[model samples]
Target: MDKTTEEKFVTLLEENQNIVHKICRLYTNNRDQHNDLFQEITIQLWRAFPKFRGDSKFSTWMYRVGLNTAITLYRKSKRTVQTQDFDAVMFRISSEEYDDTVEQQLKLMYSAVKELNDIDKALVFLYLEDKNYSEISETLGITEVNARVKMNRVKKKLKKILNP
Candidate 1:
């Protein structure tokens, strides 16, 4: 790519890097894994940048690429030995006045989210981001109805995991 394109890409990535970081956090369990995933997603985004057609918001497109890259890597066989807990890095709430019960519940919910399959996890992430069904479907390459159905099922599944 030309320098101009490279600059543009870098600007966009910088502007929206938190999206990539969030995906990394969701898919990875440790700092090393998170960094690795972040790099991989950035590489994937760079490679696919030429084909980006401005059909959706840049952040939305970033979510699609980032989530797909994460799910793809997550589906591969586990080879890395996990040496640290993810709670400290991924779930730390820095607010001094936070409620303990709410914090614990959030941790439990995130733990349950971690246990979900790749697709289900992606759906939950998108849903939590307040993406409409159409956006979710476009991101995951599923029909809108399918996205709605899967989201409902995921909600029920999460409820079971949380309550049971």
Candidate 2:
């Protein structure tokens, strides 16, 4: 990367720190895990930076790198810690209304996500974030038919988990 390219890369990353942070929160659950995941994601993004052609919006492309990194970076072989104590911490956005019941629902969603196979989790995350089938397919380099099938399966699985 030349000086100009390096400057451009820095600018892109500075602009998308929120994207990285949001994905980290969703994927990692808590502080230690969040920091580790953030570091891993930053490394992955830097590694994949060269391959980012200007074919799509930067946010979308960033999401692809992020999802891939979170899905494939490391497998935690041992379970650690326990449930989040409500009084200690929670996920909240000032721009959105925060109801305790909704927080519980969000927790349930995250729990269900944690139980998913990596590819399934990626599909689920993308679906929840309102990605269209074509966009998800493109991001994951899968065919539209495959993306559709996977999304249907994900919805059914989420329904079962949420209902049961």
Candidate 3:
């Protein structure tokens, strides 16, 4: 990659790193796996950076590439031997205070989400991020109608997990 493209890629990644991190957290059960998936997604983004045509926002492109990496290209065998507690790696309470009830509910929701299949998890991620059906369809390579249907199913499943 040329210096210009490299610089541009770095800038864009810095701004949208949270998207990659969220994907990493959603897909991996442990911290080692999260780090591994994050690294793999970064490498894939860098390699595919040259092909980015700017047709969409950089964040949107990053989402598609990051999801593709996490869902398809990442290998579980590469995870490190060291295991970390899922809560320790997945959730952090900053200095700002939060409600205990809300925190517990959020944890339960995260647990339910983690149990979903890969594609369902991806759909949930996109839906939670407020992506419209069209954007979700484009990101996941599914029809808009399919995206809507899948999202409805995911919501129903989550409701069952939470309420049952």
Candidate closest to the true structure, highest TM-score = 1
RMSD of 1: 7.4
Per-residue CA lDDT of model 1 for 1-164, tens digit only, reads 78787778888887888778778767877667777777778777887999999999898999999998887777763624223233332222121221235435456777899988989999998898899999999989999999999999999999999899
Superposition error at 161 for model 2 (Å) = 0.9
Question: Model 1 compared with the native: what TM-score?
Answer: 0.82
What's the CA RMSD for each of the models? 7.4, 7.8, 7.2
List runs of model 2 lying over 4 Å from the truth: 76-105
Top candidate by lDDT? 1
Winner on TM-score between 2 and 3 is 3
**TM-score, structure 3 vs. true:** 0.80
Per-residue error for 43 in candidate 3, Å, reads 0.3
lDDT comparing candidate 1 with the true structure:
0.78
Question: Each candidate: what lDDT?
Answer: 0.78, 0.69, 0.75
Clashes of each: 0, 0, 0
The reply for model 3, stretches above 4 Å from the true place, is 73-105
